[model samples]
Target: MTDNRVYLFDTTLRDGQQTRGVDFTPADKIAIARALDEIGIDYVEGGWPGANPTDDRFFSEPPALKRAKLVAFGMTRRPGRSAENDPGLAGVLGSKAGAACLVGKTWDFHVDVALEIDRDENVQMIRDSMKLAAKRGFEPMFDCEHFFDGYKANPDYALSCVKAAYESGARWVVLCDTNGGALPHEVSEIVAEVVKVVPGDHVGIHTHNDTENAVANTLAAVRAGARQVQGTINGLGERCGNANIVTLTAILGLKMGYETGVGDKGMKQLKKLSRMLDDRLNRAPNPHAAFVGDAAFAHKGGLHVSAVQKDPKTYEHIDPELVGNQRYILVSDQAGRSNILARFTEIGVEIDPKHPKIQRLVEDVKEKEFLGYSYDTAEASFELLARRTVENVPDYFSIERFRVMDERRFNARGQMVIESEATATVEVAGQRLHEVAVGNGPVNALDLAIRKALSTAYPSIDGVKLMDYKVRILPPPPNSDGTDAVTRVMIESAGPDGTMWRTVGVSANIIDASIMALSDSLTYCLLKSGTEAKVDA
Candidate 1:
């Protein structure tokens, strides 16, 4: 608990909500805000009060506010109207937040271009907004819009804008490189220079990633004396995307020794949170993220695994365990016995260096890998392989034969409809069950048959549901018309507990892909339920 507190302000609900294709409902805003608060963020900028009904309602609603200060963000009063009557400015005073942030045009170009007003009038607009905020007893943060580019184009006008806000009693003056194209070196020097010419108590950096340098520029700003940093969750913002808090928190906490969301969870949650957001948005997580990404702690080279086994510090910067991450000793064409043994040891299974079983398993894993089977993404497949030599695995259900029908017209139908039929069997405690089911597609048919056949044995499985499935085609080199194409499938399952895991399957036949991925999903569920799973196929 270092008292050296740098406040965290997220505009995800405000600016982030404005990202194209993003529309966080009042409920969505509340949920994300609570999560951010629980993670130790200082402020959650909800939204502009008068701008939309959802935001205005968010400000008025009594949602839980645990650790974050709720802030209403908006612009200043209009030029011709009184601050009290200007609905936009008045909404700032009317919102649920005790504090409000007012952004005003600071660039001479914006004045003449976006606003079609003169520099003096733009300065007056900022002055009036700040004064109204102060008179209304609100903590005012002045966002000097495009301040960096403004200063570059016309330093005098930008400086004049800063003076207007200060003279009118702004609490914090944030420099916005709104275009997000500024480099780290430029931001560092610019902020240091800005500090010299203005009061520096609450100067903040609000940057985007048009140049993919928002995180770097923020770190440089912090090193150069900017007191506050602002960005978004998963960096969801307008244009090329705003600064990603995932990268921001990591670099700041790990590289710069700053305190952020808790350390242990912070490191682990980086990957989890990234994937969590991606899952909600139906997007794939980047395997290349730093610290907690899938590839972050992955080992491939045999020498590297051997060295890391002795001391991971030889290749890794820090123990990934601190962040809830685990080291992976991969088994691929690149593996040596050491890599295989290292991986086995992590899972509580140790093998002799020269054991016959060890060599066989390693070669088998590598052979399948060369054929496009990646255990890294196919945890269930690996589990199956591991169990083959381990112990007996229960078969809750096994597919016998399945059939699907789709036609523009059918004998039994006046109109056209696709039909599916599947048959499966299961043996539980010496009693066997054979069942048939129908669904819309091959995967759906299998899901139906398995559920029907296994219902008596695994009664709790009625709660399981397949949430998503992703498929890719890998055709053999000499294939024609996709005859020899390998269809890879990844299935996501969720249950009553809200837990999720992805299972992968690959085969030349589409039915095989579905069945394999489904089998993996069931095996994972069984293992998770404290039932020992032995995968036979």
Candidate 2:
């Protein structure tokens, strides 16, 4: 590898799994491993095999990766045990991974206090374990846990620990900011000193994010001569988190002029990969995340929007598309004509900036926003509003009436069960259709009834599925009843081809709001599928 080339080691399956409430099933680990391989990661740390049954099964039939080297992670051989006899070391060897990473105590405090072992014995452990792994035909790497803090306290001992691993035939000696409290300058200083004893090509950096400086520290280490960086996707890890490899990769490739496994093409998939992880975890992506967030490239202020529209470089440091994100011109009270024109174009509507209707639309949007509509987060709803003004939206269906009932009753087993039932009367294609359904909740029942009523007239409705539903209660008006607050519902729907979209609705009643959003979601799906065009014709 060239001096400018940096290796990306992803530990999302191992360290990221250490996060609170995060437990990846064997299937989830397989999926994430494939995704990491697809993105050209250098090394993917599969978890400790013998420590957990799930990880053991995962390694038993590891996913066939084309690019990334599957690595098994474990601690050094136990004190007073031979590397060959230690079960932990045996587990790492039996994992059948292409590589093995063994973490050992580099900090004297951990050596004396945590492990209660003599300093020389810890060095022997690192040497023995790494030598054993290499002899077994696996590329071995050593994680010098708490190297920075240890170096600060006992520089000679920390350097000896790293030296021991390198001399033991380890391919990489990674310095770790295990406590995650080191400043960038401190990292640079320590790494520079270590490279004097060990070549930079043989060194790597692993950092945590307790002080929110993991990325900075990792970069600092690189500048000081480390060639590899270890981190997790979206910064998911134990405590505060690990360095976010997504952000680190972008900065390394785009800004710092370093070559990573994820080249320009792979960089475009970063956002998609980040979102895929969040999807598997059933969590929403952070809108403000560095490179791939929803709001990363969004411009809202009038001056900022105008500047970005004229020349994106005026406001944005880089093209959003370079990272699989797009620039968004948000419409709000702060929006100007530039914002309106840019937003219209983004939603595939071609309206002249000078058109009289553009001003009308701007004013209308502002008034509706004052009435509790947020166009920034609900682009699907904004598109519907814009399309309605420019052309007639196909009137696919209309609800004449709907009724929902909820009841709690004890069953023969003496268990109390709550049931909800909904009935819907819908007018579709000049025909009245009635349908009823029962569900676990009122929203689910209403959604089922509506879909049942319309599926016959529009068979394509059967392909649409509601993926997510979120409701927020807005503050009540000053003179209104505080107990009855307006609700804003955002529904995420997906078509059979996996095309997803979000629609929003607001009303005093939660059910009414949910229904409105659900209808809009289905309407948008039909329109996008061109079914609405066929219906109109």
**TM per candidate:** 0.89, 0.95
lDDT of 1 by residue, 1-537 (tens): 343445567888888877888877787788777767766667778998888889877888937787777888999777777777888888888777867888888888888988886668778888888888888888888898898999899888888888778778887788898999899999998888887766555678889989998888887877777766788878889998777776776677676777665455546565666666665555666667667677888888889998999999999987776555678777667777787788667656655667787777778888877676767656556666765655445554555555554434455657667767776665443456676777877688778888876665666778888988888888674645657668888888887799776677788877788888887788667766766333332
Candidate 2 lDDT, 83-109, residue by residue in tens: 999988898898879999999999999
Q: What C-alpha lDDT do the candidate models reach, one value each?
A: 0.76, 0.91
lDDT for 343 (candidate 2): 79
Model 1 has an lDDT value of: 0.76
**Global local distance difference test of model 2:** 0.91
Which parts of model 1 are misplaced by more than 4 Å? Answer: 1-5, 259-284, 321-329, 390-397, 407-419, 425-433, 477-482, 495-499, 527-537
> For this target, which candidate reaches the highest TM-score against the unseen true structure?
2
Error of 1 at 35 (Å): 1.4
